[model samples]
Target: MDSPNVLLLLTTLSLTVSSAISGSVVEDLANLQPPSDFNTTIMKNCQHNPSLRYCNSSSVDLKEIFRFTIVASHLCNESKNPNCVHSFDKIDLRNRPKIAPLYLSYSFFWKYCPSTIFSIDLSNTSLKGSFPTEVLCCAQIQALDLSLNGLAGEFPIESFSPLTNLTSLNLSYNYFSESKISDSRFFKRFNASSFIHSGLISYQECFKESTSLTPSMLRAATNGFSRKNQIVRSEGVEIYKGTLRDGTEVRIEVYRDCISREKRQEFVEECKVLVELRHKNLVQVLGWCSNRNKRAIVTEWTDGETIEMWLSDSAPPWKLRLKILSGVVAGMLYLQENWPEVVSDIRIDSVLLTDNHEPLLSRFQVGDRYRNSKKIHWFGIFLLEIITNRRSQEFERGEAGFIEHVRENYPENLHEVIDARMKLPENIFDQAKHGIELGLMCTDQSISKHPGLDQISHMINKVYESCLELAPQNHKRSHGDGEEQQDDQSKQQKTTPERSETGDTVYNITCSSQWIESAPVVLKMTSSRY
Candidate 1:
């Protein structure tokens, strides 16, 4: 039947409830379903179980409609009878076994209703005021249509978190124009039609497209982009910390030398590319502004140290270091696989380290020279830098570089060749050697002789997995002198591994990854002999 007929059927059902129930309930149900023509509207195809009266109605108080129906129809006490079908006006059960389940959808439907609600159609209803938070109560509601109604205020994007089963949502022709949603990840599936005529919802906001920010907004966010707000001055780019009008923290990158027309065009083109790229391991470019001879890109702010600063600050464990390396590699792989171009400049300076020691690759485009250079060979050089703890450029003037250095020193003192920042676990010497060997394989001059990126990733995973397994069982005490040293030796002699500064075992870090991957709760890495 048409939607108008559906509304008419619901009105008739409400009238029936009013006629059967007490005078007070009749008034309440009357409030739910406003006065409508009773002559033309009738419950045409309703099939209610005699013992347990169940019914469905729209254009009524969604919260109080079911309560009124239950009290008026003698289904109040039959809550335990799961097989009992409910009474509804014009609902054909033969064709729609789906609608039979959602007869008692309300605040606590799970505890009261027999079956799950798969869909809810409240279109052209009296649903008004704030967007209903109660909709989340329907955990199994997959398809929702709240169109052609009164829904105001900024829609709570977070309110939909519990409805993991929701597949389709429609809120078109509603009053959500002034509503501002900061994060767009929640509404990825909904198209422009769902939010059409709602001025607040736009393509730039929903898809997280790079908005054209006004010069004034940028200035207000950054305190006029003053030196006080400057976070970093790297590669002729001055980065300043700022917050949007909605209180979103952002990092504003002002190009100090994009004065040339060619440079400005490059910046604009790069912004186009950056807007398309979205990954956890890369900085998110929010928007850009090119006004009054100033060129700047606004991105999501992360209070992270550069890889250069991180390595300089303190020696991190091999497991943590390898995770950072893996993230960098993954980011590069994503760029290579998805985008037309890769992150040409992969170095310590290009990688940012989170507080928890995760890495994010920045500076995506390589500009003029790198765009023309042999790109695939650069990743091998990046790998060599991590293994040798030396910058790739430094290897150019040095004696034989990392590849040759490893070739001469392997099978004997692999420990000495590895970065002194990490003390290799004695139990996994071959694993560590294999990692170094893979790095060497990447740096091979012959392109055919070099290991593929996938092969390199697999080998790194093996080494990373080994480090995770052995790190928990093995503990090393800080080497010192006198009584403190002896005390450390006694602690190291114990079977349990040394706890970190956080007082948690190194195994805690390793276990988090294992659980994240849905792997076995415990992993056992035994000797080759075993």
Candidate 2:
């Protein structure tokens, strides 16, 4: 009986030992399934937690960011935070669970915690929220895309006042409506649609040829229309359902001018200089018109307009601003390096605003072209404007605010001049401050002190590199595409209704057409988009 009892005890002990070994093997397998599996287990197990998570908040594997981005969305709640689920070359938010809540708010890019990210794209995700006014968070963001989304409300123009280093932005297909109407007589309340009709919420005034937004003509010859561009009730510029030969919609620009030889000569000279221009940022002259009683310059249309007017009424979100600025810088850099003749004394006043707040480079006539040093100074001033949203010209000696004074006295104090947009998210201020430092370096008083466009571009690119440290992939636009552009705010954005099977899908606006007969030089009409 004793022997039998001992054998039974041994058998029980052996079984216990085997069970322990099997449990150990299972634990090892779970640990080796990659960070993606761990996150999946955590999310599925803890989907209903108070914080929407079921794991320890304290310890995070800071190393597996790359692996996490690939599968975040598949395991995460879709339709809520798309940008967070993916990443780009510059942004990475792997293993960082806390960031999940912030990115979900649809504002972490321009507002909330901008410093926490570098590149953010909430494009066409059917996102619904107020225009993120807090997008003015310091210039840490690089690229932004909120296009094709359900964005409501009049765009907050002043919100993007703080961004300085942004590069690419795409906000197409979103409705830009406002609650307030400055004009209330027509069946439609006076809104941005009065200026532009692409379903975009815009307030920037447009009429000039820029590189930001699509240009629209305000009026045709009407009893020698007064300087006032306000179109009377029925006299509003007409739009219809038509197509250009190339399948591109037909938009005309009418030129009606008074006989003035002096103005005509000036126009001719300006055109001569304009034709000399060759920069990626510069708009291509679609065509021109000069007649006995009229003179006009027809050029390729832009998407948006100047920074000032775009942000005049309200403000754009912060990330959008940065995207605009980056594009502007690329254009400016092109002018500063490849074509100094373009940027030097080209068009200070002609720097029109776009509906989207991007600055358009227009009227590039060689009027008092600056030397190399002055070129650098202007570049810095422009950079300061990009960063702070303050008028560099306003900062004469003895200016009131410290920002303007810095531009006056130090000129390199770009950081000091920054617009008080939203503060950078958390510690991201450090990067923003660094960006300002670079801006200051770019705008230093000394020519040698100032960074050239090439150097500046490199540094700006570095900002993108750093931004990748926080943001995820797919939250940024492709780099070096050279597609970023500004609008000619001088040209309004207006659209007319037309039936396209289901509903009104086409609104063909007429851009003002300039006839060669307008130019007294008797040049042949050889261009396509005149």
Candidate 3:
């Protein structure tokens, strides 16, 4: 029978079952005829055990019943476990390699069995690409095990917040990134071992000691301000790479003679705000020192080079570049949502990379007013920089600026602006064009026209997905390029000194030059002046 006829049959059977508890109606639903993928064992179990939650409903939703039956049929392999149909409350399909890439649909158990389903164990089921948010619909779910799978993405802690009853969760042995999980209230409820071997960076170690450090401790870490230990030095500011007694590497920024009282206070205030905000992509601020003659901020040391150096020296593949840009957007979005003021003065150098090329936003400038539009505009420029491998200031020499330059060449001559270092195939090239257009949309001078970071994130992710479809092709090319780039990076790192510098010079609203021409500088801009 066709779908409509099957639905009609189900409706009739439901009506008949509601009228009277007859064996015929139960049998009809159990042996739901052709085309319908109903699990006979599950339907028979429901008929036998009327105590099951959905079994005794007066009037069943035929569609929901159909979905439930389909899910049961797909998940319950009778050959493996003859008793699989007997249970609806707990699903344990562990070590089921045949069910690879399982589609845990939203309505699987949610619509018909939300209240009844308590535990789910899909461990080692070969699940991939993000947490199955469908599981969140089960409000009464107590234990969930999604371990030993290929699931990777930002762990959505906020979505799990409603599941107050969720007691046990095992996300170990996955490729998940540590986004905002470090600061979530739910993380505290679980044991640290639950996330072991998972790609998540432990934030517990970050908060063990006090955030307030004395000048003597800072000096000891940096070898009493030795010249060779210094990373970057500019007017009124000096940065030094330090190693603590416990072997924790840190970057210390010291404000020297030219600092004002107001500037010193702003530094302290910024440190306090940064201490509260924790995201994997943002450089973690470890501690700070403020005394009569000394004022400084200390942040975790990253081994990789700045984004500027990454672009300038080597030709990274399109996929790698997109991944880095995506990370940058993630970090910026976190800052925008949490503290809009810290979203000021975004420069290419402000973004530092890790050994794995993960982008971390190292610079933060707190502004007085919330100007998301300006931040969006800045991000547009940043996006263009990644796509084109050109400095935002370089466009200043042009009559229309970088935004208009791209707008003029978009769709037709976009290839002219794309970084020549990358040799993109047609499919990947299309995504680069899409990225250019997105950057143009973001760089609109009119504040009302600017897209929010969330919207930008969606667009970028869409492009990233498109590129991912051509991964096999892109990977073949990027592999050779990656080897070459790695060799170049090795050479570059030897000659270049690892530096972490934050600038104290406040810029006015109209200053369009590069914050620091050659060095990595975290430029601070007073919001009022900006």
Candidate 4:
């Protein structure tokens, strides 16, 4: 056959196949049975129990009924409560053994039937994964038993403040990671047995019984605040390495001398804020000393160095850098969501690395009012610092500032500004370009126009995942023949000018059309790089 006829025939066949598949899909969808409303049966049972106030009320909330029925259907064996009747007040599915473990979907407990449910017991249903923070929506709940499960995550201690009526909470026999309740009142309310075998250290255990240290004790620990014991000093704040009487190593942050009434009050307020803040990423405050002449905050000493040292001393791999960025995002999101105040001091020097290379936000200055835009802007500068390995101050005195410099050189001279220490592949370089664009968006001067942490988080995750996918390929390439690798490097440098001139233009057009579009775009870009 001629070329034109052959092409026409193939196109005709493709269209026919597509039409047939479309029709078949439509037919299948039409024949599908609609999901039965489980709420109907629940409502019918409620009608029989007139004694139940919410269930038999004149004005029934169908939304709440729908939510309750959905929750019940998942917990109950046959969509019926243990009493063999649908009930919204209490759901006790404890010790119900099954052939396989039950897996709760993410939406489970997202919206509880408030004022209608009082107790929830799912003690031994083999629940897996983290404790659902959505359970806090059960504001009227008196008793919640999630014991004897495989749930493992940070016990949301700070989140329980909303559960004012919670009289009983049994979290024993689980695999919770940390449960140092910031609220000391919880220690008096709940017995230690409730948290036994959960891998959770009580409040007193995490921070020794004493929450305060005297000035003399701190002085002795730090050798009378000698220069040899000093870690770092900035402004009026000085940090000294100290060891408590019990051999616990710590960092004592002494503020400016408290001579006036206002300074003393400020010291007390700062202490209150530090005591309430607790997360693995944030530096843990063990104790504080508020003397008439001196005020200091002591935090648990972390072993690793600061990010400034990490970047200046050596170039970490792309994967490790992405891990550090992700940790910073997680820590920032936690602070934004849980605390009323904002940490105004976000700098490269403020973040510390752990022995395992985990990033910990070490410095915090809680402001009286929250301004997310300021934090977002600082994070933008911080992200740029990580990408370029250049401090924001480096470009401050130039005609164009840091953000302006990035904007002027992005997609074209992006390669020049990227950290030279860490050589990047073509695919990873695309992600870096996208990151630079995100940083630009975040650093916009308009406070209201900056992207929210949620948006920034989504973009960062996409970049991190793209880097992770290419990590193994890069690893294998790194281990290849040394001479061959050197030859390849030489060839790459020789072609760099031509590639940047032509290949980068096409790549930028493709990427800009779908900038921050979706996860699929990220995957597509990673798979096929210019």
Index of the highest-TM-score prediction: 4
lDDT of 2 by residue, 1-530 (tens): 22311121122322333234332122232232233344444443334332321134355442232122222222222212333323212333322333433444433122213133455555535566666454445356766656545667676544554555565544545666743332322212211212332244333421132221122221232223333322222332322222222222222334454758777666666665554343334554433445564444545445454556554545543444454545566667766554555553322345655543445566454455666656655555555555556664564542134233643423223234444453344223333444444444444332233445565565454444344334433313321132221124212321222345543222222212111112122211111111
Clashing pairs in 1: 54-86, 54-87, 55-87
How much lDDT does each candidate structure score? 0.53, 0.40, 0.62, 0.61
Which one wins by lDDT: 1 or 3? 3
User: What's each prediction's TM-score?
Assistant: 0.51, 0.40, 0.53, 0.55
* Of 3 and 4, the candidate ranking higher by TM-score: 4
lDDT tens digits by residue: candidate 4, 26-114 = 22322323235534544544544434334545676554444333333333322123331223455565544351133233232334332
Judged by lDDT, which candidate is best? 3
Clashes of 1: 3
Q: What is the alpha-carbon RMSD of candidate 4 to the true structure?
A: 18.0
Candidate order by decreasing lDDT: 3, 4, 1, 2
**lDDT score, candidate 1, position 510:** 28
Residue pairs of candidate 4 with colliding backbone atoms: none
lDDT of 4: 0.61
* Candidate 3 wrong stretches, greater than 4 Å: 1-210, 258-263, 396-400, 471-530
Residue-pair clashes per prediction, in order, are: 3, 71, 0, 0
Worst 10 contiguous positions by lDDT, candidate 1:
88-97
